[model samples]
Target: MLLLPLHSHGQFQTPLGVAQGQLPQFRAAPPNTPANEPIGGWRILPRLNVVETFSDNVRLQPEALQRSDFVTQINPGLVVTGVGTRYSVNIDYTMNNLIYANLSNFNRIRHQLNAMGTAELIKDFFFVDGRAVMTQQNATLFGAQGVNNINVTGNRQNVNIYNISPYIRYRFQDIATTELRYTRNMVSSSSNALFNSQADAYQASLNSGTAFSTVQWGFNYSHQAVHYERTNRTVEFERSIGNLRYMVTPRFGLTATGGYERNTFLSIRGSPSSPTWTVGFIWEPSQRTSIAFNAGQRFYGDTYSAVATHRTRMTVWDLNYDENITTFNQQAGMSGGFNIGNSLAQLMAAQNPSMSPEAIQQSAQALLGLGLQGSFFDPNNFFSNRLFLQKRLQASVAMNGIRNTFILRGFDMRRKAFSPEGVDSGLIGAGNAALLNNTRQTGVNALWSYRLSQLTRANIDLTYTRFAFLAVDRVDNLGLARVSLVRQLPQLLPNMIGMLEVRHNMRQSNQPGLSYHENAVVGTLSMSF
Candidate 1:
């Protein structure tokens, strides 16, 4: 109950050994859109980073007493990317070895790896995509940041995630289209035996290729099957939805959707079948702004979903809110960031069928800007884990200028267990009771990076998080702030960069003696070839 899941969408602070998987999405491209860029062939990047750090409180203990440590870290990494006319591949591997001068027992090595690729197996009719990630994760929700591996209070766990997806699409001459998709996702944890699970999902969809001047419609059906390794529990979900839309004008449209969902776990609550309906409006004031909102009644009482987005030459903003019932594993995935970068790349490829993967990546990065890239991965939960009922709201803002980039993100999520918590039966102490409980999480994160010169840059990051265990009446607050400066040292060595950083972190809780604070300074030298 003390663990806060890591954001799985990006490379930031992702522990060593985890591979990143690509979530599959099916959508028909607008007819006649042009491809965005040309393929750039294959390239490989190799780099090394060496860091030295000094900490006043290596163990993150309470202020009454403290321990100090000087640590050194060496990281080496390699990246390979392929951008072809019909496919793309990216692979990254890195290893970090930490050495603690005063505390040799705390030394360890961490490995991280991520690989992803897409292939047009049958020209324009069939495709395959796959990804793998191996990394480490924090075992607790609070305490020190996950990056510090020296004498840390938060237990560390090894995790591996991977997935493969294949899909087929067919278009009927400017009138209609159909798609079929299948994906398999697997998760395993070395420290937590109860979390090992495998999930398989299948989907089929059909939509109008060309909207009649006043109407457009679509139908979708999807099924998911899950299996837990240790508990031997199986879960299944089947859903079907149909959508109808009528355009009253060019700028506004009305939408109506109806669906039914069946869940094996939901049957425990008396009924496994849920009938749902929603009515909403779609508004597009301009090419740069759009909004969609809907309200409906479902198995869990009143339900609503809304999304709004606006984009300018230098700024991008998005807001979203949704409510749903899912499993605990799925709820964990839902709490993280989305993979907008991949969607953007796919859209670029669709618009420019001949563009190379490298070109598509470049164009997407340019379009979304560095601050917003990869921030849009899990919007509709098409690629998450288990089943639980949850209400969530998230918002993000990104702005890029000639010399500076900034990003701000905030989210609030509340979840309740759909099933009674499982009892440990014979277990003793705190382990005897059920672990899962209703909880709420709210947090805000902000990052800013400024280019001080052609070869120098500075950055700052700040985060605040609050966790509330409603059923347990426990709450905790955590804060982190970091500032760093990086300078490219091409004059001394090609592709070399030097950095200096300072960090301060604190955590407070209602429980006595459960709080701590720490300060650290670090210097690093990195080189790429």
Candidate 2:
């Protein structure tokens, strides 16, 4: 398996300042923070990114009208964070103003907000944690750069999602633990109202720390209800799991799990209740490597899950594979499954606050690119409301040396439709019908960053993606490349840092009338106080 690890300088604070996933197979344990850290303090970071570009094919099509203009983007952001012995909080907000020098009608402004924290209601007994975010995303699986012709009318379809989750956990000494959680997520689009939907999720879980010497166990039960506002359709799901693990050795363990699931909109032979089971192992050969593998029987037929992670002084790698059934709204909660590399990078930045913003941004983007993520603008691009079975394999690698950082990644995903759509085709919005069509997506991406000097750096990004629609017997291919150089100007101002960057981007597609090439140059300056 190939491992692609995205090492970057930031972590998002989810509900309770902890990452949350619906199933145990999807979640990873959080790292332990140092006990000597500050009890409570506040830090703020402000930033900006500006760019200018001239394109011969702004619409990105073979018949596109030739155009040239200066595109200026003003991005301002603020981050406030506080950490304490028993509590933590993070609030982030950003506003992006995009202006076209010649195409004034294409101007727009975007806003993003994220807030999350955890508080111990009682000393080591009760706790509360929650996270909330509002962000904009592209509606189509492929953004404007995909094989599909770009929507130049400025009637572009964009989706805005708002989600909030809160949970409380209680522990009964070393015997057992319990949690109650709730989540509310809503989605709206610019072009079509049919894509708008709301989802409310509830979950309760209990687990034993150690029933006996070297024995651990857990149980979880969850329910989710989703409603499509425009379609007037509602879907509900119920799931339960019981698992146990016995440690044969300090570094090796055996596990067994059994579960059952039922969905209102998903029926298998006129019955929605399906029993599942799995047997797996966990192995840790050394501090540098850990591995886990599982094989199971699921509703669709067979299922498997595997994860392997290795780390060295200057390199880190992660590989994972999983098969499951899910809905479109649920995918939003699991975009790039548990990015350990990103978490480490963020920890490093938090420990050392002197790192430049440009470097941090570069590392974040590199990590994101290295994830082999499908959608350029939508993190969860492979979305569908219909019940579908999906299999995913992904690998990530990140390496850092004295003056250079490299990232590479590749992923393949296949989705099979088990149920049909509830509404007519015309009423369905872009990307809403993706599950109904058997689809496979494979992509590879790479990034390199080299430090030219203490104040200058160069970077390059290359990516290729293939989309295959098996039900329709159609395939699309797209490729992108970008090169840029940045120089920091610190002596010119106080309590502020300014940087200048020049970049060129090119994109191409295999589809006729959707293929076009263009060039762009941009300059950006940012400040922090």
Residues 358-448 of candidate 1 have per-residue lDDT tens digits of: 5455434432321111112112121112345778888877665556656677888776656544422221113422223566778887777
Alpha-carbon shift of residue 292 in model 2 (angstroms): 1.0
Candidate 1: stretches off by over 4 Å: 1-40, 142-151, 211-213, 266-272, 331-387, 423-436
Cα-based lDDT at residue 479, candidate 1: 73
Ten residues in sequence with the least summed lDDT for candidate 2: 15-24
TM-score of structure candidate 1: 0.81
TM-score of each: 0.81, 0.81
Give the per-residue lDDT digits (tens) of candidate 2, residues 1-529: 0001111111211111111111001121122323212234544454444444455455554545546656666666666667678888877666756677777787787665666777876776566666656554444443444211122433244445666666777878779889888878776655453356788989999998544548888999999888876676788888899998898998999999999987787543345568989999999999879999999887667789999988776677888898777766566543247454563354334433554332343345443432122243222343355666778887878766656667777788887766665442554544445534677778777777776665555667777767676766456666666666655454763222232333223434444454455555545455433
Rate residue 284 of model 1 by lDDT. 99
Top candidate, metric lDDT: 1
